[model samples]
Target chain A: MKPVFTRPRSLADVSTHYCPGCTHGIVHRLIAEAIDELDIAERTIGVAPVGCAVLAYNYFNVDFQEAAHGRAPAVATGIKRALPDRVVFTYQGDGDLASIGTAEIVHAANRGEAITVIYVNNAIYGMTGGQMAPTTLAGQKTTTSPFGRDVEVCGYPIRMAELLATLVAPRYIARVAVNSPAHIQQAKRAIKRAFEVQVNDHGFALVEVLSTCPTNWGLPPKKALAWLEENMIPYYPLGEFKVPKEAE
Target chain B: MAKGKVVINEDRCKGCELCTTVCPHKILALDPKKINKLGYHPVTLTDPEECIGCALCARMCPDCVIEVYRE
Candidate 1:
């Protein structure tokens, strides 16, 4: 009998520790599926970041390096430089990417490093208990802002994909969500293309996935997805932020 | 003979409530129910029979819920 869907070989058999409704599992599956499809699971190296996804090292079957908060890009840079022939990517969350690791990501993309960056943006800092992140929307209530995120003091949420696209180094940048199955399909396409850019040595590739943080958002898994539609999508606006002509 | 009911893995919903907003028939609603383990109220379909199978709700849902089928 043929199975409709089975877990990807690139992912370990261990159950994930992520809270119910968190999109980390979907993102991981996408990455693993891409790696498996590209036939590069053996040659791929992933850099995991601090925050909820830190244990990503254990999730993916490929070799992984645990990096300090916001340092995955720098570490991935080193790994890709040392093994230029292998596929190297960094999986990071908003707290690690747009907040503490902003400099690293900007410079790495500025340098046009040959690596893929899978950035998960769920607005609030997830693993750290829903503190307001740099990507948290105005009026969004996080642990840091129980009432709401006051733009006067907190400033506005940063659109990392658009910001990164402005730099010339990145060859591909797109923001897709996993809130729905259709969105998931689109996200998978984007992830595959990002990897293709790296495998083809097309400089930097970044896929900013608008994911859900049910635990931190104080919503159930289902409503959190709807919230992304109601709030997150309008602010972030999904679609290809940037893509090199050659890759297209 | 009937097709499978749209299986909603409620555990995976993020409670964004976009599904309710997109339902043309307004069959779905974000009830004022208490929070789940994740701490947000989840959406509940009030009248499943009224669903038109437009799938607008499914397409609009960011968390990948709302499966549709023929009964």
Candidate 2:
């Protein structure tokens, strides 16, 4: 019989620590599938960060290394340098990548490391209880910013992909979303392409996925998805931020 | 009246069984017999004739392999 659904081999069978309704699981599956489709699972090495996805190393079946908060890019750089033939990537959240790890990612991209970075942006910090993250939109309320993020004091959100695009070293950079089925499909394509870029050794490739943190957002799973579409997508519209024509 | 077809992209299937686990109408099930390219037993629409086009399968497939069309 033809199969319609099943687990991707790229992901381990361990239970994820993510909250129910969080799209982290969905995004994880997409990355795993891309790895499998590209036949790079054996050659893939991942750096798991310190945010909600800190425990992601346990979920992916491939070799994974744990990195300090916002230091995944540096860790990935080291691993890629040690095993240049292997496909090296990092899985990071908005807080870990956009905030503390900002310098690491910027420098790695600037140096043109042959690596892939999957940046998950759910606006707030999920592991630490919905605190205001660097990507949190102005006027958006978080645990720290209960009255909403104030542009006057808290400042505006940082578009990490756009920032990375300004650098000349990155070969490919795209921002995708996983809010709806169609969008999820599109995101998988983008993710696969990101891996393809790394497999082809096309310098730094980053795929920023606009995901949902329903538990932190204090919304139901369905509503959280809708909120992502209504708010986040508009703020970070999906597109190829920077793609080298030869890599395309 | 007949319902529309269910399409599964073989490469996209991860064999998570979330779709089979969530189908309230119980129209989907793992073959427990077949192995896909990724070498896992994937889910099969057990009784395609009984499907209601609910789309629960499509929603649950984390790999996005299930595509449902209502006729």
Candidate 3:
């Protein structure tokens, strides 16, 4: 017998803290697999941000730096600058990146920092008790938006990938979902390409992953993925918004 | 048809039931009779031979406890 799906070496041998069917774990696996496949696990440095995935440092088998909420791009920038030989990446959620870390990420990409970012956009703030986040749907319900998100007051959900794509320094920017097997496969490819952009020293790269939050969404794991496909995917379409010419 | 089976790392499993939802053959289910050290019902294969080794369960597992093998 042969095993096709084994744990990636880049992933540590421990359980994660993400909620069931949260899709964070799936994103973690994809990142870990990318690191292992690129054979750069030892030289990789990961910046963990403040959010549901704040403890990501405990899961990846690499040197990790904890960044302030929304400051992961800044932290990763310093790390990549000090050690240009090492591959540096940041794992951040929507609340940490799209909202608070907006300035940091914008500057980092604007400067073309040689780093990679794995952005998990679950729409709502998962750790802070499901508040309406910048990426939250127009009419999505959350603890802060029990009446559902009012676009008139809250404005439309910000599309960070598209926003970042507008910058010239970004070498690669893609948005993908892990709701189904086919999409998950595409996400892995996008994630791998983002890391490759950094490894090749092309420029800054980011992969925005559309994740699920079953506990916060008040939906079962299966239904959460379905809801994401029906409600979230329309607002945040999945595809590569930017690509490095070398990669093409 | 391919022959396949799963290996569950009980202690690593949080019994999230995410993996069970992705299995097309419906061979996976939480163990009601046994509990892991974490006091959670770990997922187990009900009919090992029914596994088509899709690996979707492994993909959806947050705990990374499930390993898929096929022959």
Candidate with maximal lDDT: 3
lDDT of 1 by residue, A183-214 (tens): 88899899998999899865899999999998
Complex DockQ, candidate 1: 0.11
Highest-TM-score candidate: 3
For residues B1-71, what per-residue lDDT tens digits would candidate 2 score against the true structure? Answer: 43545777654455655566456677776678888876656678777777767665675554456667676
Q: List runs of model 2 lying over 4 Å from the truth.
A: B1-71
Question: Any runs in candidate 1 off by more than 4 Å, and if so which?
Answer: B1-71
The CAPRI quality class of candidate 1 comes to incorrect
Q: List each candidate's DockQ score.
A: 0.11, 0.10, 0.68
- Tens-digit lDDT track of model 2 for A130-210: 999999988998999999999899789999999999998998899998877677788888888888888885578999999
Give the per-residue lDDT digits (tens) of candidate 3, residues B1-71. Answer: 54887888987777778787778998889899988887788888998878888799898776688888888
TM-score: the better of candidates 1 and 3: 3
How far in Å is the alpha carbon of B22 misplaced in model 1? 14
Candidates sorted by DockQ, best first = 3, 1, 2
Per-model TM-score, in order, reads: 0.80, 0.82, 0.96
Q: Identify the runs in model 3 with alpha carbons over 4 angstroms from their true place.
A: none
In order of listing, the candidates' clash counts read: 26, 7, 0
Clashing residue pairs in candidate 3 are none
CAPRI category for model 3: medium
